[model samples]
Target chain A: MKLVIAVVQDKDSNRLLNALVEKDFRATKLASTGGFLKAGNTTFLIGVEDAKIPHLLEIIKQNCESRDQLVAPVSPLGGSADSYVPYPVEVQVGGATVFVLPVEQFVQY
Target chain B: MKLVIAVVQDKDSNRLLNALVEKDFRATKLASTGGFLKAGNTTFLIGVEDAKIPHLLEIIKQNCESRDQLVAPVSPLGGSADSYVPYPVEVQVGGATVFVLPVEQFVQY
Candidate 1:
């Protein structure tokens, strides 16, 4: 079995969880936020047989979506601290950060 | 930096996140349920320096608690489906399932 960790935005978690459950794909959810945006997101810890990874990824890709978000640039005006106008730059968020790890052992009790 | 994944019980998640934030450690939370009991739990995706793993673990250990929960046994009776009488058994839950992974690359934007 492989341990699939998918980090998705909060807007997509519920729907993704529902889709996984519908397909008998059980997973655990954790509430998380983005490092750069500090926006709320969800991470799923899914345990699955190695053969089913492609299907799982398809499901995740369908549910977890990416969109643009407006935010102030961190380094406004070319690193000028003083006399700076913070423009709301558009940044893309909501994509999934996925990690697939080989499971040494899986126990259900 | 290392990616520390901690699967903790729902009851202890808030406290643990608070503790981590108090210490200036940032993490992402995922809402997840347990495998055996199908109970609600939280998974944390913490990004930390390699040198701070022990300290992160200490924080998780202190905040994520373990306790017994009553659940129905999967196989109520041995090789008998009709004459099965389900009995609730006490099982342990609410401990952290931690995985520390070596990060290949780290970026913030």
Candidate 2:
């Protein structure tokens, strides 16, 4: 079995969850913060058979849409204070960052 | 090398984190909910070398202690309503549920 770890924006979480549920997929939702943006996101732990991976990815892609977000970039460390600019920059966000891992075993009680 | 995904109770999270930090292990903390108990829990994503798996497990075991919890059992589904009785049951909870998965690649920006 493959364990699909999907990190998605909070705005698209509900819809993704609904779609997964509708497709008879069981997922564990985790609230996470992005490392770069430090913004709240939802991470889903989905265990599925290997053959169903494409289907799952399609579901995620259909649910999550990339969107533009304005965020102020963090200043570089050890940089001159006068060189720093704190202007909001438009960045593309809101698409799922997914990782597929091989599970050695799975047990439930 | 392995990615240890540990699902632990919230009560043990801080202590576990401290222990990991002291040991110089970097981990990602995620807020999660348990499937069976429907209770809030913490899921830690710890990336470590193969040789350190045992040590990491030791740290998790030391920090997370199993405890008895009073939980209301859900009534049987599709059964007679009169036959169902709800009672608070003493259940063992709070030990880490760990999943060791193989990582194909690791990337950071």
Q: What is the lDDT of every predicted structure here? A: 0.76, 0.80
- Provide TM-scores for the models: 0.48, 0.56
Tens digits of per-residue lDDT for model 1 on B1-109? 8887777777778999999999999999865665312567776789999889888888887776566879876774456787664787788766766767677899999
In candidate 2 chain A, what residue range of length 10 has the lowest lDDT sum? A31-40
Q: Highest DockQ, which number?
A: 2
Which stretches of candidate 2 lie above 4 Å from their native place? A21-24, A32-41, A65-94, A104-109, B18-28, B33-37, B54-68, B71-88, B95-97, B103-109
Chain B vs. true chain B: TM-score per candidate: 0.72, 0.71
RMSD value for candidate 2 = 9.5
**Colliding residue pairs in candidate 2:** none
lDDT of 1 by residue, A4-98 (tens): 97888887888888999899887787656665234688767887889999999999988876777798756654666775656787878677888
lDDT at residue A47 of model 2 (Cα atoms): 77
Interface Cα RMSD, each model: 5.0, 3.5
**Predictions' DockQ, in order:** 0.15, 0.27
